[model samples]
Target: MDSSTTRTKMTVEEIVDALRDKIVVQELAPGVKLREIAVASEFGISRPRVREAFSILEERGLIERTHNQGAVVARQTAGQIEALFDVREVLEALAVRLATQNAPKGTWDVFRERFGPRAIKAIETNDMDYYVEAVNEFRRKTFQEANNEILSQSLDRLYDRTRVLIQRLVLMPGRAAAALEEHRQVIEAMIEGDAVRAEQLKRANIVSARRWFQDFKKFLL
Candidate 1:
């Protein structure tokens, strides 16, 4: 029996995440065809659900749809990475500022509860994936506190692609501890209702990360 005959069932979101992870880790290289029928067969899902997952991946910039070739993983260039980081820095900084104004009481408490100790633990143990997850969760909480759907959606679109770039940045020498401290400052500013200060701290944090990527690009690329 052909191994391809076996199938695994998963929800549409699960399928999207699975495919996105593959793309992020370069398991699915750029320009590889994503045949809907084959994917549907593998996942034991319908073509329609697979299509939905494709659209989601496309929106996240993990894949692209051609006029006739269907979907393939998106190829990113250095200039594209620069532009994405520029836009992300501005938008995420704005998110923190808005969050200062709009955040509900106890929001910072919840964020701290989820990330503070866990973030430090991840860094000390060299647990890259766990650290990245904590950072992403922190970003999500910032969006939620900001209470702006449009801003949140815009940032969401860039996040998956950004994650691909930063997968290595967190592991850079001295980066993990610095990032934790930066996040702490940003959260403190938001809790103090200091919009301008929070925005500045957030932008500085993002810029610092971008610089790390620039310095390390020789190895990463």
Candidate 2:
């Protein structure tokens, strides 16, 4: 395809999506260089568009630009990951608390019923993609129901950064099952209208999961 035609066909959003998927799936490993020219050529787009997409990814903490190195998939330090988890615990705790108090009647019932069984099936069948999608959907729906736009936006950004790490961690022995149970407890507390318990449980759950992920730091960074 001609350069101009390809450039016209591919929007900045499309470029961003492609790159984001690569990063999420670990096709572009942490700290791996992302060459602008190579990505532009691969996507059949101009360098400017690729740069724009990289800017978006950078803002989302999916990639970073280094002096003389262009863009690379972001590599979180141990300290950074710990700090990220700390912030996430607080934010997610607040989200669950608000969701419990403000949820429409029966709003969380659908998720409560579906999530555990889906997670068990994923584990039994060894279906990583479906498992990740199911968990992501549950979290997304919870944040949506919370009706706190600022908190949702913050969590969304953090989720983007931690997505790959979470996927890797969930595949570890016992982590998936543990995560399922944690989700169940959080949902149950929410159902019982115990906002304080729900928030504390949510925070503890995230912190525990973060520890599990930290155990795989050798594989990650």
Candidate 3:
């Protein structure tokens, strides 16, 4: 009798992703109950597998199982968002820096342009889909090429927590253009194999995002 969707066979990972996407985009807003039975039915999976997906989502801070409410979507406070940004700077800076040295040649040529003309058009048109995909692509590819399992694992969780915030960040006036340029510089550093420079640029970008989040708090919150 609870919420239901189309049923399909899916792996545990797929179930997690489907739920995560809904949560990130606010379809599964904070405090909404995620019934294990309902989700299991929707995904055509066993209850234990749904539990496994819930465990992963909880680890990513996207959900919490309350005393009586069971598992529900989680909401972040302003303080929590700031904390995520802090950890993100360190992890992502190291990620980009290491990617510079570890990524094969030409690893960044596509990204450099993605953050260029494609990003520009996306910003101009206010295409959130393209922006989101571009950002995810860069993060995914950068970590994959970074060749550091520990760093990648650390970042994977942090990225999930702050992913929506970054999406929200672009909505601030002029923030999208600023972010596009910042990403371009970071990509340039990676392309040149300037690890230190890449790291610094990435940190600067996070710093700017944090500052803007504070400055334009009303818009973002």
Candidate with top lDDT is 3
TM-scores of the models, in the given order?
0.79, 0.86, 0.87
Arrange candidates by lDDT, highest first: which order? Answer: 3, 2, 1
82-169 per-residue lDDT for model 1 (tens digits): 8888998999999999888887766786666555888788889998788788778888888898899999889877877876678777
Cα RMSD for candidates in order? 4.2, 2.4, 3.6
Worst 10 residues of 3 by lDDT: 1-10
TM-score of 2: 0.86
- Cα lDDT tens digits for candidate 2, 1-221: 78779889999989988888888778898889999999988988889889899999999889999788899899878788888899999999999899889887777777677676776887878887776777788788779878999999899888777777788788888888888888889888888888899999999999898888678788766
**lDDT of model 2 at position 168:** 78
Pairs of colliding residues, candidate 1 = none
Error of 1 at 203 (Å): 0.8
Q: How high is the CA lDDT of each candidate model?
A: 0.83, 0.85, 0.86
Residue pairs that clash (backbone atoms under 3 angstroms), model 3 = none
lDDT value for model 3: 0.86
